[model samples]
Target chain A: MLVEKSAAELSELLSGGEVSAVEIAREYLDRIESINPSINAYITVDGERALEEAAESDGRRAKGEALSAFDGVPVAIKDNICTKGLRTTCGSLALGDFVPSYDATAYRKLREQGFVTLGKTNMDEFAMGSTTETSHFGVTRNPHNTDRVPGGSSGGSAAAVSALLAPLALGSDTGGSIRQPASFCGVVGIKPTYGRVSRFGLVSFASSLDQIGVFGRSVDDTALMLGAISGGDSADSTSIERPVDFAPGGLDGEVRGMVIGLPGEYFHGVAPCVKDAVMKVAGELEKRGAKIEPISLKYTEYAIPIFYLIATAEASSNLARYDGIAYGYRPSGAESLSELYLRARSESFGKEVKRRIILGTYALSSGYYDAYYLKALKGRTLVIDDFNKAFDKVDCILSPVATGTAFAIGEKVNDPLAMYISDLLTISANLAAIPGMSVPIGLDEAGLPIGLQIMAGHFEEKKILNCAKAIESFVEPLRPPL
Target chain B: MSTMDEKQILRVARLARLDLSEQEMSEYARQLNDILAYVRKIEEMETANVRPTDHIVDLHNVFREDRVQSSPGAEALRAIAPRFEDGHVVVPIIIEGQE
Candidate 1:
């Protein structure tokens, strides 16, 4: 089935004239149609537009005008990433009818590379929640078990790739949004180092920590998409001016004599099966001539608070732009301007988003600034230092991506604190502004996916991708029981 | 060490421009206190002499040569506005419409 082929495999077929882009797009769109009802992975499926783009790709390839190596491959985009003229609701009622006038740089780059745009995938409203239950659209279910949640705020993107609704997807990560979902859904998800991908039209959640990354069935697919979107964009001053380094040298799994650090802190509360699965990979890598050693990121425990404090503060500042006045949901019959701003946000934003905005505002408030946000900043410095020290002794750090596998849909939804812990294990990477990825390690005792996170030092995506590629050789690419 | 109460939450919601319902304010207050209690762990560390890191990768002022860039255009901007008239975003008059 074309829907079952890896993006790279599909590209090879397209290049060989064995299959047409239209056929590939139609197959995936049909798969999305049939399967997405159970999964709720996509918030919007632009089948007509997707077919048109695929046909254009076919035309280009027929005339030797293909845009890039993986031209005509379909990709799902997380809803928050702006696509001009497309409703970029961000899974919130505030922008339910809002459309961007310009495309996000990452999406624009994908289009330039001849990627057939599938549609926008669902995410948490303003990416405030972890399980995507907070999306105004609905919850995206785990393909392995319909009862469990697909992690969020990139849940839909991960779910899309996991269920084979799309071969590849683009997701933004802030405090484990990408990796956590990737782990829960049993797919390859990467959150590149901060500033690796431009955030030009990506609705900002946490400017300092947010990054756009790729999700794929295979590590190479994600690597190729990451390489395509990475590099300097004048539109985003934070976009690093560096050459793309993580492009697919497919199946390059050599890891001889590599030093891998196992942080003792990350495994503390992880489920036994997850720990066993991660340790099994360490054993396999050791047998392959890679050295594994125990290391301490003493500041690991502080990452959650630091990440939330900084991220929410930035989000409160970022989301303040969505006043009722210029281009967004405006309340009717409001007597005052403040009421317009207040009602527009309070009525439109979900509970989680409100909680975050309030907490963030409190953090940045007059007396609490030093005690909360500033303290978090100083604490973040120590976390960065801890990772720097750890990376000095090892090529990369390995750990479980979460405490356990996917939880039930409503398990942590009501308990905000418990939901925040879903991101605990993965937020340290965002805190340090480093590259991290979740590669499906194996199934848990309950048969849900448990992903092993491989994090590398800043700008060192190559190391983690290589290590994940090696791990993939051991576990093979995971397939959920869709 | 401060736990949020409804009054404080109300002030914060006001500052955040959120018109929280009474029930939401109480619920948010409790939730914020719970989260605040958890994040209070940041107080455990001694942060003296530690420089704050706002940006992970050290970036200096990036100066680009001054040049004209195309705007998205007023018409395009107005098209998405919730209430637009006379090619401008329409909102209630600020000073005159106080409650």
Candidate 2:
């Protein structure tokens, strides 16, 4: 029953004087305090700050002033996004004590919209792992089954929302980080078209593919938060100048003539249960009068390799700044500069991060650059071409968000190959820079949630949202485990 | 590809700035070689005609004006450093063969 209420509904109650913002914040904070102990979803909680913000929201409501949808909504931010004066550790010991002096563009935008900060959620160390076990802090357990993992590196954010710790949360998707976790956690997660949301404040993981996304219990809530926080900012040159659309009126199920493409490549290697769930949802949409057809993304298998090459190369270059100097953990008793850097990074970064860093450095290093990095870049063009060809045939592509339901925490940890394979379905969208969302369809036999992913061409978020809205109407809204 | 020699392992370790102990070097060489062998499967897939992509989206020149903006100033910079000495971050000598 606690998970049934949407963020908008709670905001309405607070605005109508039916309940105070303080009460709403308290309810969520208490839930998080109790549930998060088991999940390790949040690394830090600003309980006092949240209470103060809620009281202030109540004070404003008392004057009969209208408030934004997010005015009093308690939301969690991924620790990777810089929040002024808060510990912005990207789940790495390298940034253990680092507090940013300025806020990231996304964080500043959220604060400007009157969103109450619940706290900073956890993530993989430097956003490198499929499971959050790579976090320097600790593993973020799945909300449904504590023994299992909530897919990551955005696992903490997804788990927080799934556990009802926060009604909505922010996550960054690079090669399916957001959508995969959302699929695992059974929540609605939206990774807007690349450049749909600015990346000004998010700590760099892979600059080109990194995007700030939102996780909500429902489609409308996700759209509402996304619309408020998205738009061009001067601070981020990559931020696009797109018009904001928050109206939920047109999102009702009315897809009488929309073209839906079911990419054949996405079904390869997908588990039977997950495939059945996706096809069942597609069938429901077909009955509703939408056109669904099988389409081909010829170069789909190349996505993972291309993603690793490009992401690692860029990550290696970006992470070069964390050389035990400016703003992060530094080792003690290093008599030399090289020793300072080697010792600091070796001790601070988790194994996964170090692995990728080494891989990336090798890829971009002299002699290997042409064979690895350049070759991957060319393969990337073909991947984009695949999406371009598919989109020309249909307005959007419907696929499974991940290959399967949530797996146990240690299931894929030792086998990095198995872990990388989880991103098989979702990585293509990031490579294409298209808008994609993971909508919870149903739970598997193990009581784990499965998500059906919908992807649209670049800057065509409206089409993606409309299709997701139609699906949301037919399927029951997913409830959090708590 | 399944194994690397001790000399090759040491060379790569130095390149990665990892001063591995003699025992650790051999172990890492074995591990890295195994991982590389696994990843090299991509080389088998024919990509002769495919052009590589640098970015997923057609986003280009996402540039901000080259206007010089003021930072948090020296105080904030000093606050972030692990060891600051008179506006400069103190670190051990890096130049080789000089100290």
Candidate 3:
């Protein structure tokens, strides 16, 4: 059951001298060899490299030169986040052969602390879809229910952690890619405040909304991974120079006199089970010396539009670098530069990606710029103003991560609007540039996992993390029957 | 507002450098129109006085001292390229084209 241990627990075992890092890596690799085929959690498993890294970690430990607390723990990276010398396909055939020559700042920081990487996990094509179905590699199944999607575009990372393939995994959230999947998989996931983490090596899906986050079975483990990967990077200009210490002792799990806002807007269309689960947790928090109050964010409905406009516009521009001549797959038999670019991009990108790119291009094109993109930008300010005003009355806001639990894999794939609506509750935080985290509350009637989302103002991760920790302490960890 | 039509879709696709088949173009036209219809709701909101929020964080010029740092050289960079010649990336010839 070494694979079943949390990152924090694995770190403890390694520091206690009870197990070597190589053995831990080997155990997870063996589990991946057995389980990965069924769930499709990982797109690539670099067992040899992971073992080598684990051996080095063991060497460091024996020499008493322990780098960081989570050293020796194996973690999976979402395919979109680049890992040096490793194939970092963002789940599209276009970049299927694209091996990065540099590590993402988040992964680099983790490697510097001696964490072994267990290869890249699958994702929606370029992180564009809410369901992992858009991935050219294939969809990642939910560990709870094989027929259900694990939720995306970080489905593989969430599934890997849910199935105990890795105790900790790195995911990037653009329009709820991380939190939605974490909710679906019944794991803890965090999307730090905008500019909280560096995005230097992350393949841009939506540059403004994209953020690298961590997935773990527990909040403490997620916090440890967050702490390890956070800090400003010169490579990323938007990265904020903020102090981050997500260590266990950093938070005291206190909720006394804390005001938790229950946003009425987020509950309007949510499933009864999901709303009940969150309300149940809200009741628990109220009893534990926290005040729960009903709050309204009237502009909540505009988040999806704002997010789509901004995310797609950014994506269209960002993905322009994937021309045929660049470092990725190229279609042969192109006689002209225009033909080459067109064929390469069209053939490489998936349906969802193509749709977004076209939408974005049109939104930014002549005659539509002011009506669509610019209008969303102006509305974005109102959304941010809503959050700023709400924060003045509350410490953190509680909501459901998604409308419900994981749906059948192919259920919403063809219905693009339904897939887009999956991120409705979670997109507001991204639009407002605030920190958000999803903690598992419990399950519904069908036995699918449900997550309660906690949101805090800009750079107020400590508040949300503390609230998440309080919820973590109150609820029992729900393990999927993988 | 006008729904997305085939002509508009083709124009955007050309701008985006995506070569779509007739079948794919029609499919995208429908999907894009559906999405635009949903996103069009934002136009109803009044925001004449609100400032456009571009970057989430209020960060201005962040300067770093100019210093040479080790990087993956040109050879390494070219290694991942689909078509690479002697220290340069090979590509198709560029020309003005008639549609």
Error of 2 at A3 (Å): 6.3
DockQ comparisons of all candidates to the true complex: 0.82, 0.51, 0.78
Docking class of 1: high
What are the per-residue Cα lDDT tens digits for candidate 3 across A204-307? 87888889999998888898889888999999999988887557789888898999999999998899999999999999999999999899999999889888
Off by over 4 Å in 2: A1-4, A64-67, B1-10, B20-31, B44-51, B59-68, B93-99
lDDT of 2 by residue, A1-482 (tens): 33347888987777677878788888888888788899999998989989998888877777765357567788999999999878889999999888888888888888777788999999998888877888889999999889999999999999998888888999999988899899999998999888888898799989988999999988888988888778888888778878875456556656778889998989988889999989998999899989999999988877777777788888877887878977798988998888887887777776667667766777777777777787777777777877888888898899999888988978987666667767888888887888899999999999899999999988887888888888988887665585
Among all windows of 10 consecutive residues in model 1 chain A, the one with the lowest summed lDDT is A243-252
Docking class of 2: medium
TM-score against truth, every candidate: 0.98, 0.94, 0.98
**Colliding pairs, model 1:** none
lDDT of 1 by residue, A180-283 (tens): 99999999999998888999999998898889999999888889889989988888999887777667864377789899999999989888899998999999
* Chain A superposition TM-score per model: 0.98, 0.98, 0.99
Error of 3 at A6 (Å): 1.5
Clashing pairs for model 2 are A104-A201, A377-B52, A377-B53, A378-B51, A378-B52, A378-B53, A379-B52, A380-B53, A381-B53
